[model samples]
Target: MPLTLLPTRASYGPGDPIGIELRGDPPAAAELSVWRLGELVHRQPLLAGAQQTLPELPAGGYGIELEAAGGTVARTAIEVTTDVRARLRYGFVASYRPGKDAAAVADFARRLHLNGIQFYDWAYRHADLLGGGEQYDDALGQPITLDSVRALVASLRAVGTASYGYAAVYAVGPEEWPAWQQHALLRPSGEPYALGDFLFIVDPAAPEWLEHFRDDLAASVAAVGFDGFHLDQYGYPKHAATLDGTPVDVAESFLTMLAGVRDRLPDARLIFNNVNDFPTWSSASAAQDAVYIEPWKPVLTLGALAEVATRARAASNGQPVVLAAYQHVYDQAPAEASDRATAFTMATLLSHGATQLLAGEHGKLLVDPYYVRNHEAEPRTLEFLTRWYDFAVEHDALLLDPAIVEVTASYVGDYNDDLDVAYQEVEVAEAAVPGTVWRRVTRAGDGLVVHLINLVGQGDALWDAPRNPLGKTGPGELRLKFVRGRMPRVRVADPDGRPRLEDVEVRIDGDHAVAILPALDIWQVVHVAL
Candidate 1:
């Protein structure tokens, strides 16, 4: 006999109904009891071969007990708490085995301050079948067995991080290749298209394929005991067969699968990883909890990353936007180029609207020895990321809010062959307060916190420069402005995490505020109370 609870959260809010599922052979008699603080609140007879839903109860700690004729028994504790506003959480995925040591992976996760750990490609056959290949496998060919997964989950849980399973629900493995290639997503022609070597896109419209995918996903979810699924798909069109006998819309099928999964596991959190198809898959907003975009092709610089974050935030209706950038590609020649790219990306995302971060390691996973060895030589980059994790956790409240104001451009620059250089300067007729460069900004309690960055290192001396194209520095002082109300206390934080309280000169003459800084390359975070 096995009994399970749909939501494993120790706490729930008021008016939330509890779902209880029991699986066992028929019994002569069965009873289920709900207890609050050791008092029996409700008692009911259990029906054989059916799930039971407990009535909604008040918010408090609870305990459940079950008994049957054969002396079968089970008990568990539960808690109910008010639902606080959700904030942006960071996560990461680790693939490849680094010496088959689970602690190493856990250590890496802790260093990153990642709230979620994704078991990347554990069920795939290539890594499982090919043994230890240099190109495919890291150093150890450790297969992700159930026990290993459980251990990893426990490790993540110990560090207060959620665990999720990564899988391609609609793709076929290599063992089923060749024959399955015929059903692969075609490139307008009848020939079998290639989506890398391991994955062959299956026509979602095919009845047999759709059935196989649903079963596979459900079974994987049950076997892995993961909190949710990280669904990955190559957002591309297909000229292949359809499941319902008509031309299949791969994007629609993807959403259909997502909705079906949501129906099956109502409590599970689903995140979609489409490289750069957020606009096309906007329909997924209704089905998924978070929207993840991997903009790798355009190779956008820090400014471009900020712009994408703005667009993604709009598409998600103010949900968290995750920017997946390849640090190595930004500057591959210099040893510290990758680290600079990562820092710049994080800074840009934070300035935009506190977007999620995704750092990619090409040769091997973070825990791999090769990666560790290479990283040891350049330790500053690793240290920088560790600090970033700490910063994100500290300012979670400001990052999750929804308020924004535009000020002035302090400095602007471009990446010249991977080197970040500041070159352009614009002037404003009047000084303005701190403004949000990104489209969407998170609320900072009663005040609005905006992120400002200085691209030029030498601009620190330009204290009297105009704040914007139409504004000039007024009285050689910058003023903080708000939406024509009681002015609140203002605070600022530099890139190095220093905070200060100062009176800002502002002119809210036309639904705007202005602030002037004395630097060319400086990032300022302005906090304005509403």
Candidate 2:
């Protein structure tokens, strides 16, 4: 007898009543138990056809294991926290080989603390979608079996991770591009806009094409059971000519399609990729569940990383921001160099309240669009990532809060005088430093958070390229302006894998508090009570 637990629309919150349905025939007598981090939290005897409520629990992660007689039959991941901030921990997975990678999916959730996964390049085709998928090759020629996709989704759900299907909004495969010529967008001089040689761009405004895309999306949702979609774009041809030689505004057309999707499938989740910040504001309509951007070029400095995320969130009217900042250093640099670069990059984005989509299934760093081109992350890199992910989860309330404000001291001559936080061994740089400490400040709840990323001894601010390890920089003085009553209690969260709140004393000089920050390593967060 196969056993299954029905999925819910949204994640459960602490103490929320959970009523789950079990499908398929189970043993006449069974035992059900809920475990969190290895400790059993709830347990009861299971009757084949009886309904029951999960035990009230604290906010964190839990797992449900069903056993028949003495053998374990099923294990389901259950998240007990519904903090909206938790949504910022999304990770992308595309390298899995479907049914063979069910364990990999569970490993991803367990290792990264990711609450959601972007099942990239898992569709049958960009145009046809999963129109009752058979054995079809994905965009990159990877054989895709619909049964494998379904199994992967089921496994991910059992591990408490939401699955999102990846789809290009205006793309059509070459085989169908000829038929979609009339619906294709034309350049000023009349040329079809193409994204590489794989897919051609189509005009979303064309009613015929729009209907096809919409229908495919709906059919895909029903066929594969995707929690949402990761809509992709190439960040070009913002405005193009239609079949009738009429100009079409791409952003408006995108918004129309997104709004239409919401109306047609109100329960569907939508996230559009604003490639390299193009049309971020124009596309950040209410229709989008989150504003997503894949920053490249022009956005080099670490400060600029924060700026990009901050700007996207602002444009989206407070919608969550997901930055698909692919870390390409793993293939070009040593393990230590890659680890430092990855940590800085992640810290910079998280400091600005942005979710990341870099790691995929099997601990691979997504460097190229083709999942096959990704590099296997180093062992140490995975360890650091685990620590980084855990820290982010522990402080989601502070790091992911959208209401936070950026109050970092202004940069001055390679040294921000306000904090006196600069590199000790090398010259200070303005961007995501190869030397200086990158800092961002924000207010959450009754306290303020100062995120300090140690970029000391590192070279270049670009996401890709080789860089050195932490330089000779040590602890430095940190000063901030505080106006709340009572002396501010300070706490620090380092990349040491733990976030214990400690009472820190500061020298109050009038309205400012002067404190000596601990020696820098990679990333640290200082919380000041308001």
Candidate 3:
């Protein structure tokens, strides 16, 4: 018997529909069934030369089996990933160039355990790169070709990662300058404006201009094997002439483009870079897989990262939140201080469920040789990122799943405001829930997992609202609570490795358990199994 199924390797977010195709021998009279962990949930007739769509299923591993007149004809496994509704999957934005073969890039991705890769500096039209001065190849020194991109994407998928293409939609080729002159974002006098004499922005509303841009973008998608598009809009003011003629909102125009792309490639993921007015772009509720915000100007802090995560989640209706924070900013400080800050930023963001983390060189930002070479050859930076990658993989269940138990501890006030700073000194005798701190507790079968973070700089840190970040006050002893049905073995791991349970004390109450952590710098997790 010959049998086939559509999308042999299928993936779906929660609530997403899935189309299943089955083909086999005639008069086979097969009973098609789908099972979750061996429990039959779905059954249907098998029609020759026909296909059917399966009902929406929850996120889990499922098996599809077909029983025919002869016997069990075929069985296949299907996996449905979690929707990531309230969670995030941290990814790397820049191109993966390890100054060697493509395998080097794959190695870096594996080391980082990245889920997504944004191909850096790829453009289709002449104006997209170098403002029409010259059309050059990509960072690989070879001309950007469809085959190259396909190979690149295949490599990424080989390592269990997704790929996204980067493009500047509003940019125009120098050869198209005259056509875009009046349609470009202009100066005060309605004349074509220039950005440092090299780059110019096309009025997003211009009909003809929009068509040309869309055509180029569509072709790029077809030529490149990208899982999605990363629309980069360098936040700048609109030109009067272009603004007057165009009725579509600039942000809305981008959304329209995204919709068009989705229409063309239904399975592809979509993302945007909100450079300056990211908040405005984020608020639009456009259909996108994720939102990327630079957060460059406001100076990223633990509080700032948390706010972005919250806002992005709200704006996207719980889509993944991605922040492109510069790692070098933290690296410039004292070695230990810089490492702590970087780790703190990553931990805070992960705890809050931010999706992606971007690291770039600072000072003389080197892209050609130094940064790329170091990214592949340097051990220190790789080790730094490896720590984060390992943490993300180990606790993917808690990170991706909705919070079973959410707790907040107060240490510092809103770092964004000044008055909150003054309250830092007041040191209330009572403990308050800190805005930046987050603890997500989850249960796997009989095992309990907790993900915790301390975002504040001062105050006695607490396990269950005991001490502040400074280890000052609260319950001196640790507490543990249980479901009360059965007693379970318990183990704990710091940011490092697991310690002896004998040294740590744990107490259990009905349906709740708490562990008093020793004085620590960043975060800790406790695991309990019954």
How do all models score by TM-score?
0.63, 0.81, 0.63
Worst 10 residues of 2 by lDDT: 411-420
Give per-residue CA lDDT, model 1, range 458-480, as digits (tens). Answer: 22112111222212221222343
Alpha carbon lDDT at 349, candidate 3 = 62
Relative to the unseen true structure, what is the C-alpha lDDT of residue 370 in candidate 2, on a scale of 0 to 100?
A: 60
What does the lDDT read for residue 432 in candidate 3?
A: 20
Residues 52-84, model 2: lDDT tens digits: 567777776555667777677654444557553
Model-by-model lDDT, in order?
A: 0.49, 0.70, 0.51
Q: How many clashes in each structure?
A: 31, 2, 32
lDDT against true structure, model 3? 0.51
Model 3 ranges with Cα > 4 A deviation: 1-100, 124-135, 138-148, 173-175, 187-194, 238-248, 276-284, 330-337, 359-377, 402-492, 499-504, 508-514, 526-530
The superposed Cα distance between candidate 2 and the true structure at residue 333, in angstroms, equals 1.6
What's the candidate order when arranged by decreasing lDDT? 2, 3, 1
10 residues in a row with least lDDT, candidate 1: 415-424
Candidate 3 lDDT, tens digit per residue, 403-464? 32233222123431211111122232212234333344445454555444544444422211
Name the candidate that leads on TM-score.
2
lDDT of the structure predicted as candidate 1: 0.49
